[model samples]
Target chain A: MPTIRVSANGEAALETRDVRVRYGNNEAIKGITMEIPRKRVVALIGPSGCGKSTLLRCFNRMNDLVPSAAVTGEVLFHGENLYADHVDPVEVRRRIGMVFQKPNPFPKSIYDNVAFGPRLYGRPPDLDDIVERSLRQAALWDEVKDRMNDNALGLSGGQQQRLCIARALAVTPEILLMDEPASALDPIASAKIEELIQQLVEHYTIVIVTHNMQQAARVSHYTAYLYIGELIEYDDTNTIFTAPHEKHTEDYVTGRFG
Target chain B: MSPADSARASRHFDQELQELRELLLRMASRAEEQVRNALAAVKQRDAQAAQRSIDRDGEIDALELEIEERTINLLARRQPMAGDLRTLVMTLKISTDIERVGDHAVNIAQCAKRLAEALPVPDVGDLDRMAEVSTGMLRDAIAAFIDRDAELARDVCQRDDQVDRYNDSVFRGMLSEMTRYPGAIVAALQMMLVARNLERIADLATNLGEDVIYIVEARTVKHHAGEVVSDVETEGEFDQ
Candidate 1:
């Protein structure tokens, strides 16, 4: 009966209330309340400086790493406030993983890359199983199972991106935030990342920020359209793409302007 | 060469477009009025007037075909998008419905001609009401298309059920009258056919109304049951 009930999963995988992020001289994100269900992909789309990326970073306190960044909001996961007084920012990040706009695989072997996160936090008795499962979940196990010992830097850009996803999954985060994860790759590789994000929705709540409106339409079940640091409209992907209610939203989706 | 001359040139182009729209409106209104007058002739049992109505329906047919050709040419030449596409599509659909309206008018006129020889004129109050409502539906539906009014289009769709109800009553009345008087069978059958034809005209008007809605809202309410009322968010986590 709640106004924004997303699933019967007994808990919202991620929920934000009055979330705002500010820089020293200007505000990057205005107040935004959004709910993403467990195991679903929600795409955030807008023009440059629309604060989609700023809002994406708020999920795991990535904004905190910024020197002048200030945040005032409640971002909850599984009914508990992530920024509560006693919650560790480091532990919060481990629970909610992130991928960047460009692939940032560490300078290490592919095997060591996927194994790094699990090696850091996973139970030692199950390390090998964890690494294999994570790589397979990222859809990279078959390609890299033979070259597990090869350097990640030698992998193609797309492969390296998937390796980064494997690295994130290795830690087994409940939520994965990807900031334009396919912007650097070719269309084919971008499509692969999109397909992997869709597949990942079975086990992890995924939030994506992208300038590609069609990509957002293809990958997300729900879409939030932002403009000028404000959430203009949020609706099912099909409705937003084909029959948006707001004129502004329609103009943006139809390529009237950025 | 002068600033005033340049202003006059821009005004000429604007006037040309306005005149184009005016011509299209004249065509649409002519087709709409023919539908109303043809139905009126049938309900009044005025064979002379019905013949006149039927004869005039050729103009509507000619206009419908002309409009369709214009719409096709507009697509080829202008390649319109967005609202222009909607307007062009509405014109195409409205003209087809207008053609069907003309056909129904011809049917009613033929029925009036046959009934004049066979029977004393029967009271056709319900038939008159059906014609009135149906003609109004057509008029309003065309107006909606011209104005791009979604609300008026929806109202026309709702009014069709009323017209249909009157048509059914006319059919039932004629059926019982024929049963009561064996000699009246031929005339009653003609009336029945006329009523069915008018019902068909109303149905075409409904089609135009629904098409207008599609042009405006991009939603097909036809064959769609009930009102779509709410948006419910499913369980999920969205990072705001």
Candidate 2:
């Protein structure tokens, strides 16, 4: 309702313009363009194989791990072309860490789990400070502060996911991409991850791919609906739920056929 | 088991909500029309429609109770959130408004019965016009509600001034007529009360329309007609 357009002036935390990703002969993402506003959660929602996850991996060049995969078009981070030849994909991965759909905690001590990132990137003089701060930022410090030396695998799946989040945060990433990070956890754990995601938004720009529309509505500031590898609509979360402009977006959100 | 079945069920829910809103609008429209009919009956000493207006009040009362029950069931069972919550609450409030309008119609009918045997008061042309305008305002106001037309609601709100002006004219004309013909004072006074009741009905219609605008647009329009009128006059100055 404010006269000022919320989107007109801020630096986009991340953006993709006409991005297309392909696997062998199959095109996974088709001409999708969007801007993720700085320090806000942009929830990507769609049915399976809708290219939300494919597009999310594009943010940090995670799709490059798929040897048969190739990406085309721009993936910009803070005005710099992330896909540029001169920009190190390694450095891009560092500044834009990700949490996978499953909790993939390292088989190491809890302190080492979080310390792994800072150590891999060459520890700052404040390595201990980094580990403590990252765990605290991920909202897992109080639960694990006294047991920092315990194996991460000993923790519950939700705790391990939070551990993974703390590991990602250890590198001081400017952007966080989560691919259904709570899908493997119980609802209580999912709620905890959701609560953490909301808290993390204060310091990190986030893009999340989720199948749960209610989760997207509850946690996101903006929502983007994708269908069959194409971006259908992107808008504020409330508008997307209550008064979406596109028929497809409405059908999808209101539980009509995808 | 089938997509069409699911779609049909969803449509059914939407239609149910739509039907509830339409019923409320129908009740409001009928009650408003009765106000006009009661006015005509009073002026012409036509006992038939005056009696009809009194009879119609029972149906409105039934509708008011039915709408309240439906809204309560929706709130209790659907557990609606956000915009849906606003809608159910608005339905409940508008039902109360229309029900009160029905009571006013009945009151007007009672007044008509008393004045029918008394000496005829001179036809104050403005009273009839005021009744028409008030009824039109009530109809359009409820139409604005059913359609969620914020602009139409604002227009309904602005027209309240004309009804008020006519009401004043009715009062002044009756006073002068009473002084000129002291024998007709009692009948004139009853007619003036009917005009005042019609004006109050118009005011209630404005409130109903304003409530709809609030529920639909999430902007409070009550006590803000000047702001709307000014914004319309200076189109470039205010944010839409």
Supply DockQ values for each candidate.
0.08, 0.18
Q: Could you give candidate 2's per-residue lDDT for residues B3-78 as a string of tens digits?
A: 4764676576567688888888778877877777787788778777789889888888898989999889876865
lDDT per residue as tens, model 2, A29-62: 9987778899999999887788999999999998
Which has the greatest DockQ? 2
Look at candidate 2 and tell me the lDDT of residue B146: 78
Candidate 1 C-alpha lDDT tens digits along B50-75? 78877887787777777777678765
Candidate 1's C-alpha runs over 4 A off are: A1-10, A122-126, A242-247, A256-258, B1-129, B176-190, B207-240
Q: How big is the positional error of residue B23 in model 1, measured in Å on the Cα after superposition?
A: 14
Clashes of each: 11, 0
True contacts kept of 1: 0.03
